[model samples]
Target: MLSALLHVTLPLALCVLLTRCRLFDAVAVDLSYDHYAEQRVEHLPAFLAMPCNCLVNLLYIITGVYWLLRGTDNAEPEQGRYLRQVFAFMSIFYAPVQWTRLAVLQRAPAVLDQWVTLPIFAWVLVWIGFIERGAAGWRVWHAAVLELLSVLSYGLALLHERGFEVALGCHVLLAVYKGVRVQLTHGDARTLRNFMFAVLSCCGFVVLKLLDLPLARYRIFQRFTGHFWSKVCDVTQIHFSICFLTNMTSRTKKTR
Candidate 1:
């Protein structure tokens, strides 16, 4: 548990510290209020500037906590717990970072927001690794090495204006590929349904965020906003991921 907490937080702390040092000053991020479709309520405090945006993040905390408690109770192998909980912890840790980004609209939080996303998606890959290779065949160092590469992938952001986007694209692609591959290897009809839902949610998560502004032309999006729905998609993906991974990580359960 302590190791999982460290794995989730240490990177955050390092990113925050580096951001404080202006390491991502050159990074391209929308640091403007106009970046989001949700209008800031002038009467509210900065933290509540965009009520929907700030409040939407609560779903992450809720999803993360809910899934963290779902360990393999009497399962034969127990190693999947670390990967599952690490990913859960990452989700819980993510809420505040994203909320801070919308609230303060500062560089550190903005950079941290984008930086943390790399590992969050990477953890999915890690979880899939455990699903493919059971406990005994997987080692702690294997997770460490992959996650270390994920953490380092954030360096791509400093290279070009669109570097972060490029890195994020790769992470999303690899996760999707691994997910599809695992379905063929270990998934049955039930897992396939869960995987499809997860992929749809993942697509919504990306597309809605990208269309945040354009979607504002619609009345439904003016208040709720595309960003808000994107978060809904985010939490939805997490939920399905938990369901899918929980099943796959179970050693006693038979897969087709």
Candidate 2:
């Protein structure tokens, strides 16, 4: 019953809220105009970059919920330990980022902020943990490669107007890595579903933007699609994580 409620009813409720509310509509208009005006006057692309951050934040919230609920046990011992360590690191890192964004950027960071910092942190930490645990051979060369790419990406974001693209590219790679890792490690149906939803949600936003759909005018569709996709990503992640953890716990008990 709990599972059914989480799987079915929760999604339905999210769909209704996203489609019916006027909140995101107002925010979109405010942010779009703010960005356009800033670009026109200050020649600053930072304002334009804000919306993408918001989108990423939304994705993070969805994914984070999954991590919290998924219970960690379904993953292989190495993967599970890595995930926990990474998540703990991220939760710590998030405090500073959130503070800086609020104090300096003067904008409230979105829930998806975790996506920007958390996942990468998780990956790096996981790799480190893997080496520490002696579960996998550590390759300094591989670490160097990843670190170099990460630095290049960060530098690009700081140096040019195209920095947003560089950042987005890095995010795309991160998402791909997570998807591949999850699949290779677990091969769970729920994990696949989560990946699909994440990809679809990101793609859907890009499509909407490209189509130039007047979301400001079409309040209903705007709210519904916005909220629905957001929640879909959220629910999918939670479902996958919980299922993964449950599987891991069961496996461990059996082994013991």
Candidate 3:
């Protein structure tokens, strides 16, 4: 977390500044309300125009707060607490980014919605490293460099319309790889199950969002949309990630 004030804000601010400079001008983002399947209420406030999309963000904030307040053993090292808190803050901050994207349908928020996502997935790998190799395994500079690269990796979006998706795919794969590896080596049945659910939720988040338009033809998807359900899965993914990582951290504490 680096308390999220310095280490986290640095990369995120760099992302905002870089994208503002027109470096992310070519990034492909849907800046239209019609991009979603939910019908908008023009009379309502902009943030609440699409009821489902706007309200679903609350789940993220709720989940974040729950984890942030989650109790920890006094024996737990600062590293474990840092991992959990950083992730909780990420969930809390990310929902607003998505909400702003839906509310304004502007490129900045839209670009932000896509750009910030890469590091969230990358953080899973960072956490896995800590679980496997202990605190010394993941130094401050190591995380800073990883997060910086994760944020900077959005430059790929300028290369092609699908560049962001490519970067996201790689992040997802690496996280999955590291998750599986750590679970096999260090996890018990409970953590393994949590990891599986996290991975599945992540897959649902990606696939459902991708199928947002195509799935709208289905009746259930018309009102609730794949995009909306994807947010649900994203929040679920975060919850299970907290469960899995915290459990692993607890296991590490006991072993020490």
- Which is the better candidate, 2 or 3, if ranked by lDDT? 3
lDDT of each: 0.85, 0.41, 0.86
Q: Model 3, range 54-145, lDDT digits (tens) per residue?
A: 99999999999998888888756788898888888889888888898899888888898899999999888888888887876668777778
**Which of candidates 1 and 2 reaches a greater TM-score?**
1
lDDT of 2 by residue, 1-256 (tens): 2332243234333433443444323221112333211112234354323333323344444444445454444435544444443443333334344333422343223322322342343243334333233334444455446544543443443355455455655655665565566456544566466555546655654454433334424556433434334434433443343344334333433444
- Name the lDDT of candidate 3: 0.86
**Stretches of candidate 1 exceeding 4 Å from the true structure:** 251-256
Lowest summed-lDDT stretch of 10 residues in model 2?
29-38
Ranking by lDDT: 3, 1, 2
Query: Which candidate ranks first by lDDT, i.e. highest?
Result: 3
lDDT tens digits, residue span 134-189, model 1: 76567777778888898789889899888999999999999889988988887778
Candidate 3 weakest ten by summed lDDT: 1-10
